[model samples]
Structures are given as C-alpha cells and as structure tokens.
Target: MTGTAFDLPLEVLRARQNVKWRKYAPDVLPAWVAEMDFSVAYPIRRAIERTVREQDYGYPQRNGQNAELLLAQAFADRMQDRFGWTADPALVQPLADLVQGTFAALWAFADANDGIILQIPAYPPFHSSIAETGRRLVPHRMHSDGSRHTLDTAALEGLVDARTRVILLCNPQNPTGRMFSRAELLEIGRIAIARDLVIVSDEIHADLVYDGRRHIPIASLSPEIAARTVTITSPTKSFNIPGLRCGVMHFGDAALLARFRARVPGHMLGAPGIIGIDATVAAWAESQPWLDRVLVQLHANRARLDAFLAIELPQVKWHQPEATYLGWLDCSALRLPGTAFDFFHNKARIAFSPGEAFDPACKDFVRINFATSTAILDQILDRMATAVRALG
Candidate 1:
C-alpha cells in the first residue's frame, strides 16, 4: 500500500471480486484479461469516495460545474497536453464504456450488412461488435516477420470495396501491443480518405506505450483525417478503473457528430454514472504521478517476460510490444496436443486468452496479460516452463 501498487500480494488480489480474479478456478493463475492487478490510484479512489460522501448521485447534468462537462474538458486538455492533439470539448460524448462506443459508431455510420475492415489479431470484442451489429467483418491480417507485426496496408486496401463503410482501428493495438507509427497511420488515413470511409479509432491503450514511443491518434494525422474519424478512449485502462464504466467518443467535426446523433440519439447512448465521471476526471487531471509509476512497473514486467521466453521457454516466440500490458505468444513451436490456451490451463493451471478468440487462424497463439506483480509474473513463467518441459 505504501509503495508501488503493482506489488500487491496474490491473496489480496483474489479477495476482490473483479472478473480477472474471479473468472478462473482457485488453482488457476489467470493472465487472460486486460485489467491490471494493481491497486487503484489514490486520486481516483479519493474522487469516488468524495462523490459518494456528497450524495451527488443523480442523473448527470450537461452544464454548469457538472461531471459530463468537466470530463469533456479534461479529455480535451489531456489530449492537448499529452499528445499535442487539439480536440474539441464540445464534440466529446460520454458512454458507458468503449465497447458501447464501438457499437454506437457501427450502428450510426453503417447500414446492416455493410462491410467493416478490422485488423487481426485484434481485441476479441471488436469481432463480436461487428457480428452482433450484422456488419460484414473484413479481416485485414497484420504482417508478422516472425518478430515484429506491421499493418498490411496493401491487404487493407484490397479488402475495401463497394460494401465497405468503416475501418475500425485499435491503436497501441490490443494483444499485439504494436503502437502504429505516424507513417503507418498516414497510409491508413490515405485509404480511408480515398474510399470515403469512416474511421472509428479505439485508443483506450493510448497511455500505456512502453519505452520512448508515443501513441499517435489517427485522427490527429491531419484535418482531413480528423473530419472523417471518431476517436473513442477512456481513463479506465491507464488508471485501472474499468469497473467505473466511463468512456468518451470524440467526433472529428460538427457534421460527423450530427450524423451519429441523428442515428443513435443522445438519450439512447445514456450517460456514465456520476461516480464514473468524477473518477475519470480525477484520473485525467490529478493522477499523472500514479500513472508514471505504473508505466515504470509495466516496462519492467515486459522486459522480464521477454527474458523468460528467451531463456526458459524459447519454444514460444513473440514480438515485444511497444505498448499495452498484453503479450501475444506464438505457441505453434510448442506443438501441444491442443490449443496453447487449453494446454496451459490443464498442464500448468494457468489461464491465458485463447488466440482463436481473436482470429480462427491464431489457434496456435495465446495472449498473456503481464500487468501483475513481479511475483505473479514469475510464477506464471515458472508454470509455463514446467508445462513445456513436461512435453519431453
């Protein structure tokens, strides 16, 4: 409690009822979900407690010292200060979470059966979002050079056609953790612009980039790109407060905002809870020191994971991520009897996200969440090593 929040003991973590801890059996070591095992930032905690104490629980207000307006302004200011991107506070709309924002954008921008291009291996929810909305999922596979992953822009262009209406992008991309460079973003923007497709960029992992890398919002590439983009992001991932249920979607211009509003309507989207709004504002405005500490811990964990794979589990290969805490491990080399996820679960009592969930072709891979304490991570690595060695 006194030092870095990432050092929390497993017993303490298991006592909480979050999905990441509760989803597995007692013997299982879970490294599947995106949420971190770290404690909440002090500022975020204080803000939630203060809101509860004040009995400020009411329908959220839109103006005059209210949570919604404050959150919008904070988001804009944070964007400017952190990424050198100027966002319009007036265009920022609150949502229950990023998934909801994605659903809303798909519904607002595309007709039923319209094609949406998504890069894989992608966040699992993105696949479901498109399917649930009746949109055709055009999978654009990322090019992997056995070590690094890059967007296959040529494949992306080929996927687009008369039916395609949207390009759904995840930056500091999920699972893979590749923070797309500005040049890559420019190419994507070029495709979207040429095809007149709307770009819905999920930037929830924007704050978690490792090393000296910076996350560039695709919408920030130019005025033309911004005019056709909808950026959805939140403080939940960075501040470890996803249970708070707060997120924002920013439309590039007034017309794009109007188009979305016309389809979904403001009331249908429903606002985040007052508690969520307050915590988010606190996260953006007063939690930088806490975030800085977390970044340092994550960087160390990433390096430790890289070393473990090299020395102990060299059969498993991966591209060290540029951002996010997730590690996509290629387990094809292990030649397990079944999927790597099941092998780890049954043999090592460790649960990782099955790669097939992201894409059917990724059955030989599994994604590990490395945002836990050094002890937990070491235990996971040890379990993995033992399981792999048993193959002999």
Candidate 2:
C-alpha cells in the first residue's frame, strides 16, 4: 500500500524463482542473502522490456561518451542530488560489479605480500579476494558494546605499518549495517592520508541509508582524501538488479585511475550488459520515487523487527542499523546448542546469513535480511521465536 513495488504478492515473488526465493525449500524462508524480496521498479522493468522488445542486444556503443561514461554522468548527477557530493563523470569507470572492482583495485595497488586493511565483519568477498590474490589481510575490528558498533580508529592506526598498502572501506557496512558518519570518515581519512594509503571505498549501499542519515562518500570529504580514494558503487543493489551485473568505480586521481585501467584487461572488465545498462539508466534517472517507497517499507520493517524481538526473543540483542535492511542480531545470550546458523537452519526452518561469514569472531551472531513484505517478515519472526522456545 506504500505505492512501492515491494507490495508484490508472495505468490508472485515466489513464482519468479530468484535466489532469494529458490535458495531454500518451500518450507524454509530465505532471509540469508543481501537481495531484496521486492518487485522491480517499474522504470527498470520498462527499460528492460523495451530493450528486449526491440531485440537490441548488440554491444553497447555511444558517441564521444561510452556506456560507462554515460552511466557515470547519471551516477554523478544522482550523487549530487542524493548525497550533496559532486563527482566527475570522467572519473567513473564502469565494471561488471563492485567485487571485481575491489579485487582489481587491490591487485593493481598492492603486491602479493603487501597488506590490505579491512574492517572486520566485512563483506565475505573482501576476505576471499585478499587470500586469493596473495595479499595480507590486516583487520581493523570494530568495537561493539551491544547497543551500537564503533569504528576502532586507534586499532586501525596501530595496524598501519610499513607493509600496509591499502584500506578498504564499506560505508553502510554489510551485515552489521553501521553507516559511518562524516566525522568518523574524516578521522579515517586523516589516518589514510598520514600513511599515504590507497582507500577503496565500497559505497554500494549509499542509497539504502535510514533514520535521516546521509551517506557521505569518504572520498568526497576533501581534495587530499579524494586523491587517495577509489569509490566502488552501483545502482544494482538499491534498484534490485544485481543479476544484471552493472557497477562503477570512481576515482579522483588520474595516476591511480590509469593504474587500475592498465592492470585490468578491457575484455575481463567487460561493458555492462544491454539489460543492465538500460536498467541502470532508468534506475538512476527515473526511479527515485519507487526507491523512496521501498525505503519507507524497509524502515518500517526494521522497526517491526525491533519490536518483535523485544517481546518474542528478548535474548537476541540487536542495534537498529542506521542504514541497510540487515539486522545483525547478537544471539550470544541465547546460548543455542550450536552455531546460530545451524540452530536456525535445522530447528527454525529459516535461513540466515551466518555471523561467521562476516567475521570468524562473530559465531554468536547472525545477520537477518529484513527487506521483505510485512506478512512474510512477521512469519519469519514467529517461526524463529517458536524455534527458540522449542530449544528450551
């Protein structure tokens, strides 16, 4: 009823058979992944449909400006509107996805043995990329006091030694959903500048911020910070088009941009798919109204979860995320028979992203995806509460 596409009936959503719906059996509710359980924005859908109807699946081509450049322009415009940050379209590099951009940035900037600083409880791909690329992972673990999570700048400063080459930042961080404030980013920026470190900021969740919080690009703070930062972002996550595989990496330094371009082969860093490009353009250029509606639903769902847990499962502690549809529940007090993931899977018949996936030290936690219809979210909470009670 929010005039958002998220009101799609459960049957309609299930029929599509996306990863969010098909990953688990009919009996199990899938709330493990980052994808939203919502309908596509009408503008995005229309763009895709138009492209298909015209059978225009050829390689994307643009005069003067390539597809990526055009996307960058749209991205820059959106950033200016949404976050009050001015970005140059020329600084935007189109990539297949943010993960590829992160890996490429790490590979291009650091050697096999050099260290790359990551905020622990990070997106899992960061861990894999560092290991697979043979780079040392220096974790700056965030401190959580059960109410809120704080960035450990002192710990980060200590971790920055001669071997540290790059710092990866995830704004509106995944799993925990902690959106770093401008002041916090400024402090981190100071550290990076002092150490002359390359900062690859993954702000894919920039648009998903809640509670009147504005997402400030760490690179957008100052000239010195921009000079050392590479921003990896996309319309895919917020617009529900990840499978379309469209993402962009933004830079303010010419030399750093050149290095990334030189190391990553053009073919490997392929152009955005026709569908993705169309969707990206539509999502960025015309889908703000739809996005606003979706956000309203997401915020309401978050509040509902907070209330539900307070009554049904008081032992499960959580800090309401400032952004993102993820609920990082502290299940340590429950003392479940096994890992939170296992107990939820075997007993609760609900699938949640395991805390261990974010950080090894987070075995007692679990990340729940709350971006779903209220009816379904209520069902998930009811089932989880039943499972917890059954444990006793």
Candidate 3:
C-alpha cells in the first residue's frame, strides 16, 4: 500500500485496454498522454450510466452550471481543509479546457502582436497560444543551477514594455512539476501588480502536490494581486479527466470575467459529455478517498524513479517533484548529437516534449511523464538508460 492510504500495489495500473480491444500491436509504454491508469471511480461511472440510459447528451442549459459546478465547490472546501488554501467558487466559471480558457482570457486583455510574457520551462501550449494568435512571446528564462531551478526575476522585469500586458504562469508547473510556494508566488504576483500586468495561472495540477509541498494560488496571495489574476483550474489532472473537457476559469476581477464573457458570450458551450462531467464532479465531490490512495502510490513511484536514475542513468539528473507527475530530466551530461527531443525519439523510441517546445534555451533537457505504473516507468527508464549509454 506504500503509505498512500488504500495499500494498492507499488506499480498498480489499469489503462490502454482500448489499444488491445482495437487489435493494435503496442510497442510503446504509452506514458506520453497525461491520463492516469486507474479505473474511473464508482460515482462517476454510475452518473454516466444513468445519463446514457436517459439519452441526455445535449446542449448546456441556459441556467448555467450550478449542479455540475457544485462538485468543484465542494472539492475546494475539501482541499482547503487538507492543504489550508481556500478559494471562492463565486470567482470560478465553467469552461471547455484550460488552454481554451487561457487563450480566451488572454484575448480579453491583449492585442494582436502585443507582447505576452511567458516564463521558460512552462506548459508548451502557453507558448503556442501566444504565437498562434500572432502575439509576441517574451520569454523570461529560468536558471538551472544543477541542484535546483530558480526564476530569473531581473531578466523578467527587463523584458516588460508598455505592450507587454500579460504573463502566463503554471503552478505545480507542467513538464517540470514545480509547485511554487507562497513566498515565490508573492514575488511573482508582486511583479505583475507593479507592471500593471494581468496574470494567467494554469493550476490544473493543484491537487496533485507531492510530499509536504503546498500549492499557493497566485491570486490568493493578496487582495491587490488577486484582482489581477485569472486562475484556470480543473479535475482533469487530479482525477485524470482531461477527456472530460470540463474546467473552471476563476477570476478575481469581475470586470475581467465580464470582458471574457463578452469575447465568448455568443459562443456555444457545445455539447456536454456526460461521462467526463460525472467523473470530474465525482472526483471533486466524493472521491477524496481514491485521491489519497493515488497520491500515496505516486510518491512511492517517484522515489523508485529517483533511485533508479541515481544508480542506473546518472548522466541525466532529475529532482523529486513537489507536485505533478512530469519529470524534467537534465540531459546536458549526455551531450547528444542533436536536439533533446530528436535524440530521445530517434534513439530511445520514447517521445517526450522537447525543451525547445517550452524553452528554447533549455536545449539539453527533455520532459517525461512519470504518471504511469511503476512497471511501465521502469521499462521507459531501461530504454532511456540504454539510449544514454549509446550517446557515451
């Protein structure tokens, strides 16, 4: 049970049966996707079954998402109790996914070709969302001092211009799995407020914090800071419900939320996928027991991976993440022949998002998802070790 509560196996998993049922030959460990391998919790399954039996896949009701939103609300209370970080559900709005909400929120405050500040080693989509909209992406690089990664605050301040209007941030960050503490977030929030900049915080992994680390929401740092923050949160990461397409865009600024609504007001809420919502709602409202179990096992898996790297693949360094399941493996020691992404894919047959995707300066680094069964992660590490050995 690995001290995670329910005593599930050290490498327990239940997933990708879809590939088998479809008659496809599988060679990949299938760790690329963010989805977890656990079975859908019982309440969610029951809800979806009832919905399907009633044939209720239809447009979102005009009354807003009070019934469905209740789960997130309850979950917030539960999280506050567990972690001491509280949020007001009144500030939260239902959305399709975090990226869409991020883009929509960015659209509300910035213009085409207007500068958007993004800290390096971020969620890759944050970079793309800015460029795809023709906005200038100003990268505020972070420094990796071998043992730990730290933000370059001076470099960030230097990049700001009158046109630089927004900063996109990831907490319990994607790829690197960093959960910024309250002091760190305060410094960041302080920067935004001083620059009169709006902040877009992608907090999908808020619930997946590991060990004793806490995820301090940038908005909740202070009243002034809160007024300038737009936090995108969901159970998609915690409960492995990304397929659900249900998320919340929390705004401390009513005027800002109104602006976002104006931008997407007439836009369709689209059809609600009953299964996804049920799973998401159940995860937030009633699946705390299951969540505790998952976190417990996750820590064991993380420890095992760390030990393996320390002994078997010392060329690539990794940290024990305080939150999230992604690992940023420092491959600078390997000095591979090409980019980290190409090197890993061509040599290892394992596809990880290249550092270039998140931060171009991080040319020697690669991001891997550790959110899989220990057995599969072991296979990946074995292949990874072999690939690194080939480089030597």
Candidate 4:
C-alpha cells in the first residue's frame, strides 16, 4: 500500500475480485489479461469518491456542466494536448466500453455478411466484434522479422474487395505491441479512402507508448481519413480503470456522426454511470503524474522481461513492445509438449493469454502481461524458466 503504484503485494492484488486476479485459481499466476496491477490514480479515485459521497447517480445529461459534456470536453482537450488532434467536443459520445462502440459502429456502417479488414493476432474481442455484428473478418497478418513487427500493407491490399466495408485498426497493436508508424497509417488511410471504407480505430493504448515514441491517430493523417474514421478510445487501459466502463467514440464531423446516430439508436448505447464519467474526467484532466510513475515501472518491467527471456529463456522469441504492457512471446522454438499457454499454465502455474485466441495461426504464441510489481514479475519469469528447464 505504501510503495509505487505498480509494486502492490501479491496478497493485496489477490484480495481484489477483478477477473485478472480471480479468473484462475489463487495458485495460478496471471500474466494474462490486459488489466494492470496498479493502484488507481488518486485523482480518479477522488472523483469516484466525490460522486458517491454526493449521491450524484442520475441519468447523464449532455448539456453544460453535466457528466456527459464534461467527459466530451475532457476527451477533446486530451486529444489536442497529447496528440495535436483537434477533436470536436460536440461529436464525442460515450459508451459502456470500446467493444460496444465497435459493435455499434459496425451495425451502423456495414451490412450483415460485409467484410471487415483486420490485422491478424489482433485483440481477441475485435474478432468477436466482427462476428457478433455478422461481418466477415478479412485477416491481414503482420510481418515479423525476428526483431520487430511491421504492417503488411502489401498483403493488406489484396484482402480488400467489394464486400469489405470497414477496416478495423488497433494502434500500439495488441499482443505484438508494434506501434504503427505515421507512414504506415497513411498507407492504410489511402486504402480506406480509395476503397470507400470506414476505418474504426481502437486507440486505447495511445498514452502508453514507451521510449519516447508518440502514438499517431490514423485519422489525424488527413481530412479524408478523418471524414471516414471513427476513433474509439478510453482512459481504462492507460489509467487502469477498466471496471469503470467508460469509453468514447469520436466521429470526424457532424455528417459522419449523424450517419451513425441514424442507424444505432442512442438508447442502445447506454451512458456510463456517474462514477465512470467522473473518474474518466479526472483521468484525462488530472492524472498525468500518476500515469508517468506507472509508465516508469512498466518500462523497467519490460526491460526486465526482455533480459530474462534472452538470458534465462533464450528459446523464447519476441519483439520488444513499443507500447503497452503486453508481451507477445513465440514459444515455438521450445517444442513444448502442448501449446505454450497450456505448458506455462500446467508446469509454470502461470496463465498467459493463448495466442490462438487472437489468431488461429499463432498457436505457438502466448501473450504475457508484465504490468505487475518487480517482485511479482520476477516470480513469473522465474517460474517460466523453471518450467521450460524442466522439459530438459
């Protein structure tokens, strides 16, 4: 309780009921899920506390000084200040979460059986979102050159067809952790524009880039891209508040916003709770210092994991992530008896996200979440080493 946000004791984390901690048995170390093991930023906690204390729970209002408008303004201001993307507060709308935003976007834009082009080994929910919305998933696998991953724009070009209506993009991409460069984004934008497709960009990890690399919003590349883009982002990932369920979808202009609203009814996308809205406002407007501290811990953790893999478990392969706490590890070289996730879970007692969940072809991969304390991370790595060595 007294240490840095990321250094919470295992017992302390286990006491919580969040899925990250409770999804598996207590004996299983969870290096899976995207949730971080950091304490809530003080500002966000204070905002939630104030909302509860004041008994402010009510229907969210969109007018002046209400939760909705404040959230919109805060998000717009954060976009401008952080990424130089001038977002319109009027076009910002809230949703229960990014997945909901994605579903709504697909429902509003693409018809059933239409295709959505998505990079493979993507965030698992993206696959589900496409399926749930009755859209075909056109998988575009990223290229990995042993050191890093890059967009396969050339391969991407062939995947699009007349039926493709949307290009779902994830920046600071999940699992692999590659932050698509501006030039890469421009190419994607060009394709979307030429193909007459909408681009739904998931940018929840924009604030978590490391090594001083900045995240570029794909829609920011050009007016044409923006007009065709629907940006979905939230403070949950960077601020470690997923349970709050607050996310925003920004349409480029009134016309684009109107197109969406006309199809997806407002009532279907219920507003976030009063606490969620207030916590989000505090996260965007007043939690940079806390985020900076968390990032420092995450940076150290990433390096530690990289060194541990290289020295202690050299058979494992991965691309050092430019952003986010997730590590996409390729355990194919180890020739484990089963899938990497199963081997780790059964032998190491550490649960990782199975790569097959992201893409069927990545069965040899397992995504590890390294956002815990140094002590816990060391334990996780040590267990992994022991598990791998036991095979010998």
Candidate 5:
C-alpha cells in the first residue's frame, strides 16, 4: 500500500460519476482517460469549499500588473516556482481548458489553409483542432525502438513547406511518454527558427515526470525561443481538477499576444468557474506536499505495471514511460482477432485508449492509465494476463 491520499476504494471512485468511471460499464476497469484516481488535495478542496460556502460566483478579477487576470498571475508564479521559468503575467491569458488554448493559438498564429506540423501518435484532439480550423496537418512521425521515442528531423524537414506556420509540440508527450530532452528541444528550436515557425507547446503533463527526469519548458530555453513559443498548461493535470476546467495560455511575444487578444472576444468566452479559480490558486500555491505524495504513489504504480508486464505479459512490450501515469502497451505480438483495444475490452473487461485514436498506424497498441491504486492496478493486470493466457 502506498498509504497516500490517492489510494481510493473502487466503490468511492465509482460513486464520483466522473467521465473516467461513468463512461464504461461498472464491471470494466477504466484505464483510458488522463484522469488520475486520486483524492482532491486538501488545500484545493478547502479553497473550493470556502467559495461555495460564501456563494462567491462572480467574474475572475485582474490581479496583476498591466491588468493581468488572477489566473494568469497564479500561473506565472507557478512557472517560476516549479520550473524556474520567468513567466510574465501580462502575457498570460486564462482559458476554459488546454484544448481551447490550443485552438486559440492555432487560430492566432496560422492563417486559413496554412500548414501546421505535428508529431504523430499525438493526443487525438490535436488532429481535430487542425482539421476543424481548416489547417493542413504535416505529421512528423516519431520512431520508437521499444524503449525511447525520437523524432526524425529529416522527416520533419520533408513535411514542411512555404505554407507551414506553426509546430504543435507535446512535451512529455501523450501516448509515447517521451519527455523530450533539452538537447532535443534545442534541435527543434533550430528547425523552428530556420523555418520561422511558432511553437505551441502542450506541457500539461510537465509536473508528472518520474525516474529522475526533469521537464524543461521549451520557452525557457532562451529569449528568442521564448518569443516564438506559446505554452498551454494547467494545474488540472497535476492537481486532479480537470472538472474545474481552468487553464492558461502564456505568450512570450507581445505581437502574438496582441493578435490572440484581438481574435478572442472578452465576454463570449466565459470566465472560468469560481470554484476552478479558487482551486487552481490553492493548487499552485499550497498543494506541493499533496502532489509529492501523489507522485510517490504514481511512481510505485508504474513499477508495478512494469513488473507485471515483464513477468506475465512479456510479449506485450511495455515501453516503461519516463513520465506521466500513462502506459503505452504494444500488443502487436499477441495477434488477437481484433485490435488490441477491442480484444482487451471483450476479454479482460478493461478499457484502454485505442492506440489508433492517437495515430492511425498504431492499431497494435493501447494506452493504459496507471495513476490508480495499487490494488486496482494489480487487478487490471491480473485480469489482462488471465485473458491472454486463456487465448493460448
């Protein structure tokens, strides 16, 4: 037992009725979504409770120099404290969530029909954002050797054209779990600078890095790199408050910031919920201890998953993620009748994110959420192993 607040009973988790639990049949173990099975942090919970008790549901106030929003100030402070990045509140804008910020940045930086470069095996919504916004997608596939995933710069160069305007970067990436190194980021910076491209970096999983790996925000590399980057991040991923729906977009260039502000309407995009605001402030300010404990549990759960696969499901090929609670499992060797996702859902009663959802070519893979209680994780693996054994 990790003996942490993250360890919750199945009954309690099911009762919450969040999408992670409610989306599947009660019998199916949900290991799909990014949601963590953890209790709300004490400070965050108290902050929300105080707001609810006081009936404080009003517009969020501007609380920093240059008339910056309160969320922006909180986010800036967090960047400084957590990542050693100096984020100016003036350049930050609060959005409903990371997706909103992504879309906004894509719209602000790229023109209609402009080409946008993305690393493949990416988060699903990223593909949709480009499609919905009428931008051309130039996919740069990352090569994986069952251990580390790296981008092919030659392929990246081949994909770019005169129309390319933005490169959507997911650091500590989603399905592949590649926490890009500073050297890697520098190489990307060189490409972006040469091509005059703006980088919209999704660092939502920045805080979840494990195994002594550090997360460096691409914008923190240098003044020039910072100027060309827009960072989209939130406390929701780190603090388990996605339902609150608050995130921020940090701009390093004044001109880019001005363009975004001009494109987005002030009142049309509703302010973040008061509970979310309060929770976010408390989360960034006072919940580091809770986060530390949650990381401990997550790290242990990851090891348990690694051991389970090595012992029982050797053919499955777990990549052993360096960061995030997500596990990218390669089930191609099993050669089930159907895709790995459907096979698991039918045989083991487990719901994993279909790898094809991340990239069309990843039909043999499945992404699992390991940020769960050890007991639950063991149950999931046991069920999976039993299912696989029965097939033989």
Candidate 6:
C-alpha cells in the first residue's frame, strides 16, 4: 500500500476478488468493481478491528449505547463541513447501505404511486429497486451535449404527477462523474418544492469531486427544501469501505422525521449500522490528510487516463469528468460493427458495465473506472486499444 503508483498491482487486483480473475491469465487488468486495490487506511482498519475486539457485532440500537449512533452524528458533521449543510444526529437514520437508504427514502414518500423519477444512465440499481418496490419508473434522462452532461429540468418537472412522491438523484453522479452545480441543485430544489415531491439525494460520491467543482447537497438549499430532502452519505465510496454496508439518511422536517423514526423500527431499521458508522467517523474525523493525498493521486491518474485516451485511443470518445473518479467513455467512435454494449462484452474481453445500464440514451457509452493507479489505467487503455484494432 505504501508503494509507487506502479506498485499498485494489476495482478494482485485481478487475482483477489474478481470472478474473471480465475478465468483469465495474469495479463488482464480489472477495473470493473468500484472497490479499490489500495489497502484500507491504517485508521479505518484500526477502527473496525477495535469494534471487532470489543464484541460489537450485536444488532445496533438507534440511540441506546450504540457506537453507530455516535458515528451517525459525526457523519452529519462531516457532511455539514464538506457541503455547507447542517444536520442533527437525531435526525440521521443509518441504513444497511446507501442504496438501501434510497429505498428507505422511497418508503418515506409512500404516497408516490405514479413512480419515482429516475435520471437515466444512472446507477443501474435504481431501475431495479423501483420495479421491485412496485413504483412507476419515470425516466428523466440527462442530456449530453457530447462534451458535458446537463439534466433536463423541464423534462423532470414534466414527469412529476400527483401520484409521484419522490425523485431519487445521484450527485457527483455514478458512471458519469458530473457534479451537480449549485444553480442546478437550486433549480431542482425549487421544482421539488413546487411539486411537493421528496428528493432522495444520494451523495454517496459526495467527497470525490474534481479540483474546482464543489458538491452541492440538495438538503442544504433551504428549510423547505431540506424538509423534503433525504440526504444519504457514507465513507464507503470515498474511503473504499463498501463491504461494511453502512450509510446515513438525514431529514430536517420534524413530522417527517417522527414518521420515519416510528416506522423504521417496524421496518427493522431501528438497529444501528455500527461498522459503517465507526468507519465513517474515523474517515470524516481523522482521514482528511490521507484523503487529500489520495485526491491528488486520483486527479493525476484521471488526467493520465484522459491524455492516453485522447492521443493513443482517439477512436474512443470519453467525456472528461468534472467530478467523481469514474470516467464515462463513448465508444461509438470505434464503430466495431455492432452495438457498443456487446462489442466490449465479446470482443474487448473488457468487462465494463455497458452504457445501456446507465440510460437508454447512452446506448453508445460505457462507464470506465479510473480510480486506480496510472499504471493500471495505462494497461486498461492498452487492452482497449488492442481490442478495438483487433475487433475492427
């Protein structure tokens, strides 16, 4: 873990967790999973180990003698500091994870029968969760001008109906790393308030932004907006601790909070998410120095990826990201004689989550993970380039 970027091993990564690792030879690089190759930071490991040693594996209590409770409050503070949004510990609800948090937000707006609004080319689970939950799937696709991504605010507003109760939003959006601007969030907040729709703001990637762009948590907008907003954040993505299965949900409205608090127990959510909370507290309260350095490395790796794709692999179209560590690549330029989805699957031997998984409009795109070292990214580019030329 304390080696040069090259010391980050593609073989070790490919060998460890990926299913493809056992099937393929050592030459291939793995970038499919969101999990990182780097070892968990010293502080985070210590926190989890301490929890383990203390026999803290029992079900967590919402507010009674629970470390999760303490950590939930810390996560709120961290969100406030990072996004200029204020929240209270008592108002924060810990879920099994962020995706679960989103579902819980959906439950909060049980009145939304027409379905919740999903921005396409989103995290694929949103679509599945919607169908599984029996809500209508209202697709509000993001418009890409070929260079940047913009939400069709008018289109989203049009999707809202009397039966629609909530809009689930991914900020510092997954797959495509575009961070929503303050202006964008304000417009969205205004629409949600006007339509009386609750906003499930999944800021899971809240901490991973580009150099200049700031993450605008929708809850921080104003009292009314915060009232209707359910803000979810965790150290899972930023700190590379997703296996812990911990995340936070914050609501400012007392009546809404009371309803949530009362129902959460019946829904089996009154239990605390101790691992998530402890790791989050350590991450927010102590891991800033490590995070700062990692950001620098990630930025460099991102730039390195962009330059390689632009020069060596010009046949691939990649939208340069303004935030997040993920790269959204448009592979249509390759024109490998079939749909972009199947091309990478069969020919490339590259296991990228297809563009179709994000949104219908992005059938020609692919979500590329660039959260690893420059060396690994270099290998990925090389493999993609070879796949393109060979398949063509």
Per-residue lDDT value at 47 in model 2 = 85
Which pairs clash (backbone N, Cα, C closer than 3 Å) in model 1?
Answer: none
lDDT of each: 0.91, 0.86, 0.72, 0.90, 0.86, 0.74
Off by over 4 Å in 5: 1-3, 60-68, 266-268
Say which prediction, candidate 3 or candidate 5, comes out ahead on TM-score: 5
**What local lDDT does model 1 show for residue 331?**
94
263-365: candidate 2 lDDT, tens digit per residue: 8765676667768877898999999999989999999999999999998899999999988888888899998767898889888889999999889988888
lDDT of 1 by residue, 1-392 (tens): 13464567889888888898899998899999888989888888898898688887777664666668888998999999899999999999988878989999999999999999999998999999999999999988987887689888878889999999999999989989999889889999999999999999999999998778888999888999999999999998888999989989999999999999999999998788988988898899899998999999999889999999999989999989999999999999988878989999999999999999999988889999999888888899999999899999
The best candidate by lDDT is: 1
Pairs with backbone N, CA or C atoms under 3 Å apart (clashes), candidate 2: none
Q: What is the C-alpha RMSD of each candidate to the true structure, in Å?
A: 1.6, 1.7, 3.7, 1.6, 1.8, 2.9
lDDT (10s digit) by residue, model 3, range 143-253: 666665776666777888989989888887777776777777887888888999999988888888877666777877788887888888878778766776777777876
In model 3, what is the error at residue 182, expressed in angstroms? 1.2
In model 4, what lDDT does residue 216 have?
Answer: 94
lDDT of 6 by residue, 212-239 (tens): 6778888888899888888887787788
How many clashing pairs per prediction, in order? 0, 0, 2, 0, 0, 4
Pairs that collide, model 5: none
Model 5 lDDT, full chain set? 0.86
Q: In model 6, how large is the Cα lDDT of residue 368?
A: 76
Q: Model 1, poorest ten-residue lDDT window?
A: 1-10
| Model 4 lDDT tens row, 1-392 | 23574467889899998999999989999989899988889999898887678786667554556678888899999998899999888998888888999989999989999999998899999999999989999988887886798788888888989899999999979978999998899999999888899999999999998999989998788889999999999999999999999989999888889999999877889888878888898999999999999999899889989999989999999988999999999999998767888999999999999999999888889999999888888889999999889899
Query: What is candidate 1's local distance difference test score?
Result: 0.91
Can you tell me which runs of candidate 4 are displaced by over 4 Å?
Answer: 1-6, 60-64
Model 5, span 12-39: residue lDDT tens: 9999879999998999999999998888
